[model samples]
Target: MNDAQALLPEAIWRDRIFNGDWIPALGGSHTFTEPATGEQLGRVGLANADDVTRAAGEARAAQAAWAATDYKERAGVFRRAALLLSKHHNELSTWIVRETGAIRPKADLELREAGAHLLEAAAMLTQPKGQLLASASNQLSIARRVPHGVVGVISPFNFPLILSIRSIAPALATGNAVVHKPDLQTPVSGGVLIARVFEAAGLPKGVLHVLPGGADAGQAMCTDPHIAMIAFTGSTAVGRSIGELAGRHLKKMSLELGGKNSLIVLDDADPDIAAANVAWGAYLHQGQICMASGRILLQRGIADAVIERVVAKARNLPVGDPAGGAVALGPLINARQVQRVHGIVEDSVAAGATLLTGGSYERQFYQPTVLTGVLPGMRCFEEELFGPVASITVFDTDDEAIALASATSGCLALGVITPTLARGMRIADHVPAGHVHINDQTVLAEAHAPFGGGGTSGNGGRHGGAADWDEFTQWQWMTIKTEAPRYPF
Candidate 1:
């Protein structure tokens, strides 16, 4: 039994499957290290453009049979896989913590979200496929949904489990084969683990192929003729390029990109409660999430009190290795990410933001930083820092608050904390973020809820719930005629 304590460090996670065979990666391999300890965990095979071509071709050939399979059979695969994921959470989470630099709780949350994704996909299979339509007399007409053949999924390092699973599970459940490219930094948790669970659950070969790869493989997937769609979750710049590629290829695409989300503390809010929410929203997983509260808007009346409370929490939260579950925050992904995070903070400080309690780092573990006097044009308020830096900007009235909220590339999430729920709702109505939270924090997620972003954050495509069918399938209108007498055309 592979439990948390019994798991060994040297266990290599080498998985690169094409078609039904386990083949060596022609693009060479990459070695991964535990971010907390800098210890070499394992190596993963990297794929090239040729490998993507081969994988997409095989997956395209396999998608027809998978789509024609009985709906019960398809639903069963997800059910069993969901149970298997839960059963193997202990072992998989060990790898998650070491591979992704996530704390135990965060690792567990990923596992739970993954399992929920599978279960939700299973239920989706049995839902109404299409709706009855009104047609001419003496004729029956219906509109139905059809799979998009093969889908290519590209995911990043942070929250690998759900980020990849969100697309993979739904695509497969809806009868589309998948060619997945997980970040080379976290292949095991992102790609290999999903493949293993589905394979164990009796999914046929070639229906799902996970290839740990680089930019070439990703671009190949985007341009590959056999692939019908692309689902990507990462930085905005990469997403924009992929969107362009998908557009050129005329392939269906879903891009969940970056955000510098805002959490607004209204004048009537309880400062202590609002501060707690801000701290959690900004610092969870070292502020690596796309929905992390990078900008905190404080109403001028309660600005000072909330800032003090937030500073105390920032100071008290411990940042270190998360293996033992003692640390509140774990290390950043690596030295490069740490440098990027610190560079953002340094730039923000230089741009007139006052560093309050924390702005330094000990190796990869960045301090839980809090900054004040942040304005619209400052780097901290403008760009998605993607680090544990809470930049607070003060606003006087509702008009000013709404203007501040609307003035950004950040459009993923907006949170407003107010004693009056109606006021919170009123404020939320003016914001253009895809997700709005009243009396809560910015980072909010549910497997059954519709999720995506606005403006730079997304291209108006949504994930989860009814959005799955719209994303993974194309609409087909069918009409039945009783006799040979048809339209004049």
Candidate 2:
């Protein structure tokens, strides 16, 4: 419709890729519409079981050669890919904003972070590999890291660029070939643009394949014998299915799923700082983030002051078209997401939660919402709403606060806002989350950090920094003997 949108590939807008080339799907195509404007952007090819199987087979064929490549040469490809991503940041960010309804600032941040993540994956290549072991016998034993052959990467719609690359870059860096299945809602930015960037960086043919499709394609990838591992980022419900299927074949999986994250405001905290932190954590990108702070636990002594500040900030935040400029919030991904969020808010209010400031929507855009008097039994406090809504609950004592924060199906991240760092660390130690923040918010992530959750939030597979090498690879022990070893006859 515009100059920026015109840059999208017209020929392969409705195609899946195999062997580094776009091919039409035997299955019919699906049209993607802009969430904000409700205008049809373009049609995307829907990969069937056959398509996915072909992609996986090709990736398996390519993996051995790719793995044999020198680590430095592979690192060079990642570095060049990162540079190309940075150079095309504006175009990619525009694509993200158009398809995902992410505000300009959030979209820009995702693109920059995606490039940095690529560079981080490249740096991991230089890290020391598996180490020599201490043995009781007179034999030299060493464990070496080896690629998993073919990795199936399933990414979600929200934060498509970063989330997709979060696994893709690391899998490639580890010398594994990848077959990527991006969400159907984000075919342009998530699927096409990623392939182009790697293509420009001279990634070898068949090393990385981008196949855009839905459930059938995903299932095919999981069940494919050639796919040695699956890296998925999506809802817990789907993650469970993938894990089960992968487990049936004894295939490895790294899953980063949903969270009902909590942010605690201690009595000694500055109300303004606490409010600001919670606001960003709860409402950024319309709170579609996995680590979005859906539950806010405030100590009774400071509850009133923090609520007042938070309500004021939430009311004043901008909500409008992302492309219109300077808006703090934008539309949810689609109408179904809008209905889901609104239903959660209304049900929570009916169940005795008080709507503090905003609880209204116009089309796909829902106002930044805050709630008070949310108790443990209510859906708002218990469920992962994944919207621009923060439910506030007051705790009378430190033990009660900790209990309330830990009372969830699983923990991904938890935050403590306290006057003293020591108190924050003490509370953080008791929380079950993998990531704990002192005097910050729960929705914090870095490219090179060990980023994954414990319990239901993840399958105990970490996705970034050194953790990725472990997730995407397997260990093989090598042994050598200076003399013939004694054997039991």
Candidate 3:
């Protein structure tokens, strides 16, 4: 094997794919390092504006032929891809750990979910197309779901494999070509791995293109005329910018943005169970998930007991190199993320919030932190910390608890822990989040569930299962006249 193939184990890493062949990027390349060890891993070629245009053009050219192919044939490719993903799950998980600092279990989970996404997309092939409609006596009318031609997918760093494939699988299943731009921080685990899987599965050439680059490349994909839609998963700020550009060009856009989610513990709940769930939700993958619990709302009756339990749990969870051994938490993605998490914790403490435990950092590792007395106005309470920091706030009554949970402008996911399912259901109904869990934490996802939020959390774009096809395809209404129509002219 060549040196690049040995490092990546994927032949596509030698160059970016365009027109069904590997080609060098015009904008040179960038090097990425392992976040845990700060050691250089590999360099990914950068795609310039010209490169983006070419990818979109190629995808547009190939889309018509691919869409016209038999749906069963398309389904076969995804089935093979799913098998390939499972076959290479261990290697992909290791790369995920090295590139993104995810603990071993979390990395493994991401690969499993990635394979599930591919399988789910394959199942969508059996879903019925547009429904038959009632029409006049002489006219036959029906709605047909058609491919959008080409889709531009931009995925995030955390859970890179699952998130990127979440969009890629559906786009291909619906007979649309795709140009994918994975986060520059995790190209090997995210972009290259995906390209390798599909290529090995015998996916048609020029149907899917993987381009790894920074902001300029992403902007080019967003504004490219040949791209019929843009599906992005990232921060709200970036989503807003992409939304504006897509709107100007009248292109379809689906955004899964940031979250300031909440997890509420009621008075009747068991303190131990609630605390365990909170720790898992707030610290898993170092709280990098969009649905990670940012605020913990505790009823005054059980506030102190639950706080003590949560503190003890956080203190015992191991933190270190993810690849070394069993560890509950891993380092943040990079130095900037560490600095940002610490700054939020320090500023919250300065604003009169109490730091119950953890508030220390070394290099990219930040200890799992718990805070109390966090009021509504504090920065940590209002903003997204996106780390292993959980802010606790006590509520006097059920009304107050609901109010606190709904205070955030953006709602992605919410959790309610109550003694009875009735109470939990009632509280969950009032919250505006996309997903709600009873007697559980806010951080949860499945490959076949509708997984996007409302308000600022997303652009009403649903991903996964049958809902994803809405964003990847368009509905066209057609009518056939069996007789001459009578009209007044």
Pairs clashing in candidate 1? none
Worst-scoring 10-residue span by lDDT in model 3: 1-10
Query: Per-residue lDDT tens digits of candidate 2, residues 1-489?
Result: 454543355565555554577677767687888988888878877888888888889899999998888888889988998887777777778889889999888888888888888999889789877899987587889998988999999999998988999899989988899999999898877888888888878789999988888899999999999999999999999999999988898889999999989999999999889999989989999999999998999999999999999899989999988877788998899889889999989999999999988899999999999999999999999889889998999999878888999898777889999978877887887778979988899888889898998677989889788888889889999888898867999
Pick the winner on TM-score between candidates 1 and 2.
Answer: 1
Local distance difference test, each candidate: 0.88, 0.87, 0.88
TM-score of 3: 0.96
Give TM per candidate. Answer: 0.96, 0.96, 0.96
Give candidates' CA RMSD values in order: 2.1, 2.1, 1.9
lDDT (Cα, tens digit) per residue for candidate 3, span 1-489: 343433355444644533455678988887888988899888777888888998999899999998888888888988998887677667778899999999988888888888889999889888987978999877889998898999999999998998899999999888899999999899977788888788878788899999988889888988899998999999999999989988888999999999999999999999889898888888989999999999999999999999999999889989989999888888899999899899999999999999989999888989999999999999889998789998999999888888998998788999998889988988888888989999889988999999998778998899988788788989999999977777999
Q: In model 3, what lDDT does residue 66 have?
A: 88
Question: Which window of ten consecutive residues has the lowest lDDT sum in model 1?
Answer: 3-12
Q: What is the lDDT of residue 338 in candidate 2?
A: 88
- Model 2 misplaced regions, further than 4 Å: 1-8, 12-18, 135-139, 481-489
Assess the local accuracy of residue 439 in candidate 1 as a C-alpha lDDT between 0 and 100. Answer: 86
Residue 84 displacement (Å), model 1:
1.0
